[model samples]
Target: MESTSCEKNNVVDALTAVEMLAALEQYRAELSEKDRVIADLRSRLEILEGVNHELQLQLGRFHDVLKPLTVQLTHNLQLSAGRHEQYALPTGGARLKRLAISAEPVDVGLQHTPAKKVPKNDV
Candidate 1:
């Protein structure tokens, strides 16, 4: 008769089993936490996308309303300037530049962001 060996039996040690269970529980907890964070980020992204769409709509409306005024202003400026050199002429001690400055607060309907400074010699 052939002798049977019991050493090859699949068995887990007590300490190793406990460690595996603990590791599995820890992994589950980490996964749950990651899932929650991902959900929050997705929600925030949706809100930001909505805000961006609204801003684009507002910008389109702004351009629509300002088109005529902008055309008229350009015509007047061209007439007064006569040539490119006269465009830099000072008015009331201030040069013709962007109205908003970096230090000024711009209203975005939700919060205020600092306006970017328009560099000199840039249109």
Candidate 2:
């Protein structure tokens, strides 16, 4: 009876060990997948960082180029402003009113109307 009881305990322990091994294998597989995902994300982050650095460099270059142009533009504006009695625009709104607001009427029903074909490109 003692031996039989020991055998039963041994069988239960063996089954427990097998279940533990299976769980460990499953956990190992999950860990490996997570590691792969982490590596992929890390690579993508590196690429984004590289692009950001490149863009930053381009922005710096553009700032350097624009500095002189901005200075020149400001100087030119100052000169023009000095030439005018006042810096403000003319008060009459005459220029704005000069724009044509409506299209011209087409004489489509006229007997003299002839359909002009587009010229062919000979080249």
Candidate 3:
């Protein structure tokens, strides 16, 4: 009876050991998968960071190029505004009224005449 009880305990212990081993293997597999995912994300993040840096550099260059143009445009606008007082530029409504008074009335029905098409001679 003592031997049989010892053998039962040994069998239970062996089964528990096998279960523990299987659980450990599963955990290791999950950890490996997580590590791979983290590595991939880090790689993508590095690429995006590089792209972002390049874009920032391009934006700086664009701003540098635009700065002089903006200054020139402001100067031009100031010059034009100064000239506006000397030039008698027509106002919008006055120009429209002048154009309307000068324009001739159009005959809508006789506006367009299509040319007659000659019949093809089938020789």
TM-score of 1: 0.55
Better of 1 and 3 by TM-score: 3
Candidate maximizing TM-score:
2
Residue lDDT tens for model 2, 9-113: 999999999999999999999999999999999999999999999999999999878866776575578778875323333232222124355544456576456
Best-to-worst order by TM-score is 2, 3, 1
Off by over 4 Å in 3: 82-123
The superposed Cα distance between candidate 3 and the true structure at residue 91, in angstroms, equals 36
- After TM-score superposition, the amount by which residue 76's alpha carbon in candidate 2 deviates from its true location, in angstroms, is 2.4
Give Cα distance to truth, residue 80, candidate 2, Å.
2.7
* Candidate 3 lDDT tens digits, 33-55: 99999999999999999999999
Overlapping backbone residue pairs in candidate 1 total: 0
Taken over the whole model, the C-alpha lDDT of each candidate is 0.72, 0.76, 0.76
Per-residue lDDT over 32-116 for candidate 1, one digit per residue giving the tens place of the 0 to 100 score = 9999999999999999999999999999889878866766676577878874543454433344564446643455652555456
lDDT for model 2: 0.76
For candidate 3, give the lDDT. Answer: 0.76
